[model samples]
Target chain A: MSAATPPSAVGPPAPGDAGVLVIDCVLVTEILTGFVREEVGKVGFRRGVVGLSGGVDSALTLAIACRALGAENVVPIVMPYRTSSPASERDARRVAAQLGADPLVIDISAQVDAYFERLPDADRARRGNKMARERMSILYDVSSARHALVIGTSNKTELLLGYSTIHGDSAYALNPIGDLYKTQVYALAGHLGLPEEVLAKAPSADLWEGQSDEEELGFSYALVDRLLFHMVDERRGRDELLRLGFDGGFVDQVARRVRDSQFKRRPPLIAKLSQRTIDRDFRYPRDWGR
Target chain B: MLSDPDVLAELAGEARPDPVVALAQGAPRLGDVPANVDRHLELIAQAAERGADLVVFPELSLTGYFLKDLVADSAVRLEGKEISALARASRAVDCVVGCILEGDDHRLHNAAVYLSRGEVVHVHRKVYLPTYGLFDEARYLAAGDRFRAFTMPLPSARAHREWRAGILICEDLWHPTSPAVLARDGVDVVICPSASPGRGVGSGAELGTAQSYDVMTRTYAQLLTTYVVYCNRVGYEDGVGFWGGSRVVGPDGEIRGEPASREEAMPLHRLERGALRRARIANPMLRDERHDVVDAEMRRLRRRSRM
Candidate 1:
């Protein structure tokens, strides 16, 4: 009511600074399944295929795929490198058995090793990226063979940080679990009735011996999920993030990576010399055929 | 079987004691006419079987909300198959459906169709087309120029007479003019079918949309002394998610009934005409509104600007 106070001083509505979004798991499951069904159906694909990695993300993705396009319509492909843990293969089989999902196992060691023989000086990161691409190639080949759409397994945390190899684990026809953070992934995995063995284990890509994703990223998924929830979803600013007690270094690094990985999430840019460039003006939805 | 006892009090003496309006909160496929029409028919039959005399669907109920150029593809004539299907279904229960309407002059309006007993009774084209935030209604569809209440003729002998009902799309009710106009005209019920998305978490309610809408609709009901029925869509389209918390707010601004959160539901509530009468008598907001003074002031402002 004071004349000195300006009316235009008000800002936009404050973002929801609520703690980690405790999801309605049932609704989320229904939505994910519906998304899968709707997305696949729109493209006229009757079946879904996922590269099962024996991790929580792929497991959740597989469960959703089964519910969406019946168990019979989903093809779980377990493509493992020669150095992959035996427990991973066993766990994949267990999940396949649990869901009545008939899985197709392909040993990708021969194919990857044959290619790497030409380049012997490849490091851990290089080998890891190569392995990811090799697995993705096998998934695509299986998809073609079985006439199924490849379901992506990367979560929002890995996605924001560009943790996965592009056109490798990231290449897919559609994804059911990409929106979920790693912590939420664990929660949903628990809700979906995955064994404690899987949930209790340190999260890894099975890239190298004892290669945990948390170790590589240098932060626990729980902390990162919490931080990302505030910084991105809630749109809290840098000052607020630090005020909320997040480490400045981690927040800065995550912000940089999310900015850097923008290209990974979008279509490749086309030089616009014509009146109708593909992404410029002649844009159509991915499911435009429907 | 939970019901509002205040509305039940009207059973003894009021002209229409219980007006059953079904809030059909469904996430319609984007730009799919025939399929959405079929889905509407299914919901109508379900609601009618549950004894709802009226069912209101979300804005752009036949076509999803975020259509840009696809609005052209989704546009349907009032004489088309979708309307025919809706009309046939209205034989069971009155239906309010949102769609892109192609007019005689080839103009299109984002409109709400009121179907009653196998006939298209009224079409209230959206008056205010929002162009902010996630909305681009002004850019895509032609904005309609008028706002008016239609009539609802119930079957009972005493309730057979036409009841004045105003229709507003998503953003129209946000403005004061539409509701004020309808309130002055003594509209008994205001049906708002919205595709409002879920946003914010701890801004007092589950969603920022829900909190703001709750305040808006409840305040409007109190001001207008009319039954406010809000039917919102659920499910994600492209990326945006609509939170479905469809409900009926009494003229007292108290929520009578609501469906479960973020799910497909057809929530039914009985609107009490006696309660509206009492609220109107109690508040008299509409009766006290000085439209003449407002009109004179507008003219004077215009004259001053011109001079």
Candidate 2:
């Protein structure tokens, strides 16, 4: 190769638990940024918006979005609940500030508390669902106000685990980081020059006071990344995973979650009452250019 | 596992020559010969910096695709300025470019010229002009009557090796013999420069034009036991969207690297010539092909089916 490999202008390799699926981050980022620009431009859209959750996934998406649509065009709205960590908000603010993005900070505490006040019998699960929906509601309102399409921040590992709220956090017009695994998100976050604090912090949904993602999922992102990379992408069967030093119980659990939550990854299935079913025959893209 | 340099040298000599080839997947404006030629030179230098031994562009890339009456203005003679600049750029890397070449008979042919070693080496004009559907090539440009492989210099880090290769314009490789004839001539590499547009709604089974091309190019590689360097342009020119799915497939009939998208890109791929030798030795399909019998039968059928 000429020029002594060009000084790795593509960036260094991000560490991963699974040796498989080590992406070419430079090429991937370029192609993905180009994709976002092309798809958005095809529909005559010059602006975009994303819900900034202070998590690595959203941080990575925002970075790519900023590159694609420019910081001025990308509106990162941070909607924090009362119980949401101060560090998370600080990180989100830092991300917006670093990108020169004027973020809209809308606290959803009053909205969530008001809804919970009426449903006094609502448990933590019910409250969490409501909070997720409330945040989305604010995001949509902001999107309308700014004439921007909402970008999603759900990761592939989380989607597989059904860790996100349906019709709330899962709803989006377009998503860039959804294809990456949770661990891959961290790697890309590092490459994109996200704050060290954001990368170092334990990932959480921030629905409660101290709810870490690993605790809820009963496995680490590194472990799940390795398992899912082999299971989903590599198409490794149960025996193969076991042969590759994976516990049988862990494999069974991950496999069951991925299989059961397949519905969350797709649109609502409509019955084929007509020739062009809503989710079938009449299905199309976002109509960027017909 | 002895560390013998002589054994390593012998093995390396037999290994595949994985030379880098860059695909210039940018759209050229209609009849913009000078600018397009300049762009080609820039891409050639960039490809050379990226270690590319050869760089290819789309069909009639000097002009735009879907040329109606603009080909006359776009056509250039062999000694034209555009060819001369490209020939100078060839000092950095080999160049295969599609153009409307002005023929000796004073006609314009949809042509692909092979430029290497600061000279215009060979020109393979388009053998087939698609007149149906969206294409109207037969109405304006002269069709190439010949199809043959030429010996071109294959640049390597150590030394230059002579390689038998062929070039097929957009619609030429659709026919079976376009690739078979080259394989019969023992060509190792065949470059296909296309301006195919993206079409159809992506379904569960396919991705429209990309999927259709995948089957065709991969089948050609496997059948001929040869490497197929397929470079298709991206970006819309006059409402027609070109799906940039440029790829370099080895004799194993698989994509060697990530393909380009619907963007103006110059994706570099290192194609291994060793894969051809490996595939041929493994299948022996080319060795076992009875070209004489097939040729004789085709002639007999042609002679008998006369009106």
Candidate number of the best TM-score: 1
The sequence of per-residue lDDT tens digits that candidate 2 reaches over residues B143-254 is 8888888877745433334567898887887898899988888888889999996643312233467788898888999888888989888655444567778888888788
Model 1 interface root-mean-square deviation: 4.5
For each candidate in turn, the interface RMSD (Å) is 4.5, 12.8
Candidate achieving the largest DockQ: 1
Cα DockQ of the candidate 2 complex? 0.02
Q: Candidates' DockQ values?
A: 0.13, 0.02
**Which docking category, incorrect, acceptable, medium or high, applies to candidate 1?**
incorrect
Q: Please provide TM-scores, in order, for all candidate models, with all chains considered together.
A: 0.81, 0.58
Per-residue lDDT tens digits of candidate 1, residues A1-290? 12222212122212343446577576677667778887787677989898887888888899989988999999999988889998888888888788889999998889888988998998888998888999898888888888898999989999988888989999998777777888888888898898676777889999888788887888788777878888888788987776666667778988998999999998898888988788667744443324
Off by over 4 Å in 2: A1-18, A287-290, B1-182, B185-229, B235-307
Chain A only: TM-score per candidate: 0.92, 0.91
